[model samples]
Target: MESTSPLFALRNVTKVFPGVRALDDVRLELYPGQVTALVGENGAGKSTLVKTMTGIYQPESGEIWYDGQQVTIRNPEDARQMGITAIHQETVLFDDMTVAENIFAGSYLTRGRFGNLDWKAMNRRAQEILHDIEAPLSPTAMLSGLSIGQKHMVAIARALSVDARVVILDEPTAALSHHEIHELYELVRRLKARGTAIMFITHKFDEIFAIADRYTVFRDGAFVGDGRIEDVTEPELVEMMVARSLNETYPKVEAPLGEEVFRAEGFSHPTEFADISFAVRKGEILGFYGLVGAGRTEIMRALIGLSEQARGEIYIEGQRVSVRSPADAVQAGLVYVPEERQQQGVMLDMPIYQNISLPQLHRTSRAGFLSTRNELAVARQYGERLNVKTSSWSELVNNLSGGNQQKVVIAKWLATHPRVIIMDEPTKGIDIGSKAAVHAFMSELVQQGLAVIMVSSELPEIMGMADRMIVMNEGRQVREFTRDEATAEAIVSAATGVRA
Candidate 1:
């Protein structure tokens, strides 16, 4: 096998699973001393290619070449030993372990004839790596105590510990604050400066353009295009990924606004948000705009009864209601679609029909036993309405792709027949097509007199979909804007406390 003249390359890769071809004839290349971005919508085979490179999956037909030579990656360890490493969105660090321990988890330093663990040497090296990455933390600090950004740095340190020549970062800044994301960018630059081939994957085009040197696009499990970042525009890249120009990303519909349907007066969560007051009218989508730590999510959680100490008076249709738990809120005709679908929205192992019917099992059951026919009917109705792509209503929620899984979550909430639906980061990790679908569905729901309270960090969503928006900062509602008055500049300024 001759060296391919690139640090790493995947040629003509194909992977198949039951009822799906995850990757088909995908080609990708990573060059030393440069960052190559993998741009694609969810379920577009970007993840599959990364998995193949990391030894999680063997391609049906493909060749993985490293430093111009063909190689077989038997397992994760084999990939790591070959200098191909990945730092995923979720940091794989033990919470109970020290930073140094996490950095040198599987492979540890040893000394002496008996080969005893070398804690001092390991800690010193960990400190050096942390400093190199501009991470401010003690190597002896527990991983649990550090913030999400710091945990990511620990993952990077682990990659450094292995002397990784090729590094793949999958949505690394998904949970990072603006400042932390800039720090991560600097760290990536340092890695690239050291001649490490970097593969960056993210849904954010701004970040991709800012940091990536080259870009490769994939669509529907097939390679689309690859070229220098300077040679492609954002709109062009988006078209390549979704097979359509997203001229209207939001697809917000104009509907006649009705009387106030849901209102929260003096809503307060002791340590999270304070004095949050807002009213959402029927057929209107009230947007909540804020920065990462501005307590937008906490307010929604409180309204949905997730916060026990949430002090507030919630009124639906002029009558005050006491919401002490999720069930209480749902019974009040107010349902919440949580941001983390896998953790709070749906049960992955459960069938789609069951998940859809779980919230309203009492309505679909007779004498405490769930009526399978009723459940199926309800799931089928909402599934079609949301245009959820699935093998069948009996399929497990986890079997669906990220975008379809999100639709399932939305479908389950819609099945509850709530008058007021609160969505938190509704399209956080979904693809452009699914996002458009969800946005369109939201428009349809509001047009049908279903009031929606949408909490979002994406400015474009806030600007495009929101009829009116309330900006929060440090637990307080600072500013409110109607659709005509709201601008990205104004919203960001309010969210960051730069303007009052």
Candidate 2:
């Protein structure tokens, strides 16, 4: 329930960077016991706003008010002192430290004449906080031993230690499992019961609708709208974030399946996946559906020769091939577009053209030297094809937005001209428009007789774009479904090992 008076407020805030206006005259408010969701696409002002609130970056203009009193937070310590703190998607905990130590790291409890550390009191308080949240965690346990979800629980316990009134969670559930997410929801409700004001920054609409009481939307470094969650629809929220009414989020194009292009027989990783037998034909999109630990990505990695000791008999165009390394896989007309595009797919510091032309250096070179003209042409060709929004071909991959960087990754893979292309989580962190573009591009690829294998956690994406799909559960292929046969329930059941 929202109170008449806001617990914290950001009024007319403006923040600017060297080349961009990160935030522009943005206004936001959080009331006691209310869960306020901050919704935005990647590169929106949400991050800037969070930084400003958490004292990471001071606003060039405007004011911050807490409990009806204006305040200036010079650093993170000041923000924490004022009952403001945040938990990021990545848990920040020292591996060598215990849960209790991490919870009271900086603000340690001291006692006795010599002012020695009071570990007993801190451990007791940590246990109380953990019990309050119903988290089954030991305060004396090493932080390194806990799972990702447990680490987040410890972070929440830390917030309670500081008596946090305004707690900002930035993509907290991004890496959490379904069960863990539910646990987090229960913890959040407990926080609300204690009159804590929560500011949730996330791109997931499902989570927003599930937990948020009030909603605030931001677009292009400006405040777009704010309202009660029940008052707004998903499409309306999408419009607010992307500034476009995307009638069709997935542009799936139907194409006739051609002759078999690639096949894997009894592919097995010692511990990852076992006897994964599947085949993809030319002009077909094969979707791999599974939970996080269901071996979807491991199968792809093994297919691309990234997993050592992976045993599989691969066939390309009915001929047996040995994939001993990534080069061998490429030579055998197979390429993988990895999920971690920033770390593996694209060279972040390199120019867009260089990243695009990297795999095609042989074709883009005359003798032993590379041809700049050929490089630029290849980059321009796929850049235009993918509709990458960039200032110039020389723009560094790091400078591009998440969606555009994904485009660059796809363009680089397409440049390889692989017969079998494996795309892992192709649109994981991109916006709807970019996702549609990538979907359309996949359709185009298959239409041109290029076999595609797509590994995705998003059910809607798999159902929308895949011609055929397979569900993996605990290192095994459990079931197969055609586009018409795959349902949310069926796929999820198969992925979770529920024989339905």
User: Model 1, range 56-141, lDDT digits (tens) per residue?
Assistant: 99888989898878999988889999988999988788999999999999899999999999999999999999888778889999
Provide the TM-score for each candidate, comma-separated: 0.96, 0.91
Off by over 4 Å in 2: 112-116, 347-354, 361-381, 392-399
Q: Please give the lDDT score for candidate 2.
A: 0.90
**Total residue pair clashes for candidate 2:** 0
Model 1 residue 91 CA deviation (Å) reads: 1.2
What are the per-residue Cα lDDT tens digits for candidate 2 across 326-367? Answer: 999999999999998888889999999999999999999999
- Span of 10 residues, lowest total lDDT, candidate 2: 242-251
